[model samples]
Target: MIRIVITGITGRMGSTLLRLARDTADLRVVGATERPGSSAVGLDAGLAARLGALEVQVVDDLGRALDAAKADVVIDFTGAEVSVGHAKACAARGVAFVCGSTGFSPEGLAELAVCAKTVPIVAAPNMSVGVNLVIRVAAELARVLGPGFDVEVLEAHHRMKKDAPSGTALRLAEVLTASLGRTQEDLTFSRHGQIGARPAQEIGVQTLRGGDVVGEHTVYFFGEGERIELTHRATSRDQFGLGALRAARWVVGRPPGLYDMADVLGFQGNS
Candidate 1:
């Protein structure tokens, strides 16, 4: 069995992950953690209404939680600030990390990459298998379509989500930019007012927020007299939680490095 610890135990994803872990045979919840001064600090993680009853408490002290728990992997669904500390602590303790936290700045990502030199870390903005596959397909489409198509990405998330464009949207944009041999800054076009005609080399991104949308992404490829559209919609958070566990299992004994769902799905490095 894979002994696992969860960061962000009181959050929506964390609670959902706890429930999913209960049903998996190869994994066990060894620890759960929230930030200091959190109201959930002393609650039973396994007693979440959706998870019924088990023997795990939501903790606050990162060091104490990991030191007292016999976990082989730590799954982080926390914010980037907290995740940075989690990464450092997990690396120092030689624990594998599966991070689903998003919205990290370039500098924060650089820090995580440096941390990965000491401990294996599997990180993805969106952990759904289908979403990862969409990235592969979108990259191929961008390569084949070249610059003829005016690419626009649309994403919708729940009102409670804090980020704009969604991380998955940004990843899709990254893949498209790479496929077209362009940097994100060179290709991304977000503007208003009397904007000139769309540039041949630019990709546009639009975002929407409403309701309880689990997640949704649509890629539009427009050409003369024709258009191709590719989309992926997530119906629940369980898929993300399950995919994270799958990644955690895959990174169990691997060497220290940065990895993503593409790696988990066995895609080419550049994909």
Candidate 2:
């Protein structure tokens, strides 16, 4: 069985991961961590996740937990501020990592990549299989449709979601921009006031947050006579939890490197 360490164990995604890992045939939850001072610390990770008790306690000290558990891999669904630290800690211990955290700045990502040079790391803004497939499809559609088509991204999430536009939406925009050879400067986050006619190469990204919507993203490629929309809506977090677990399974026993869902899913073109 794959012995696992789960970080951010009390959060929505993290809790879901805990339940899924318990149910998965080849996985075991050996350790879990939460941010320092969080009330969830000191609780049995499984019990807190409603899985009764597997004797895995959630601690705030990640390094100590990893060492104590003899964990094979760590799955992180924490926030950006702590995510890099967790990666670096895992790398220092020569433990593989699977991160599903979002809202990381470019520099944060670069830091994670540096950490990956020491330990296998699979990090993605979103870990749902459909989201990964949709991003790839978006790239392909943008490539085929050419620059004549205007690209726009729309994404919605629960009110508690920390990041606006959602990391997955930004990733889809990145794919669209890359496929069309448009750089970050060509992107427009909003069109308030008199933004004037949309620039010929502009890519628009919009956001919405309310209620308990799991997640939704729609990418539009608009041309003069026709338009194409590619969308994915996640009704629950189970798929993402499963995807992260799959990534955890794949990252173990591999050489040090950074990977994503595309790698886990066997999409060679993106990898």
Which residue pairs collide in model 2, if any? none
Residue 82's lDDT within candidate 1 is 77
Candidate 1 positional error at 62, Å: 2.4
Instruction: Check candidate 1 and list the clashing pairs.
Output: none
Taking all chains together, each candidate's TM-score versus the true structure is: 0.96, 0.97
Instruction: Report the C-alpha lDDT of model 1 over 150-179, residue by residue, as the tens digit.
Output: 898999999999878788999999998899
What is the C-alpha local distance difference test score of each model? Answer: 0.88, 0.90
Best by lDDT: 2
lDDT of 2 by residue, 1-271 (tens): 9999999887898889988998888998899998889887898888777778879888998898988978899999888879999999999899999998999998999999999999999999999998999999999998988988888999999999988879898888888888988899998888789778888999999999999999999998899998899999999999999899889989899999999889889996761
In terms of lDDT, model 1 sits at 0.88
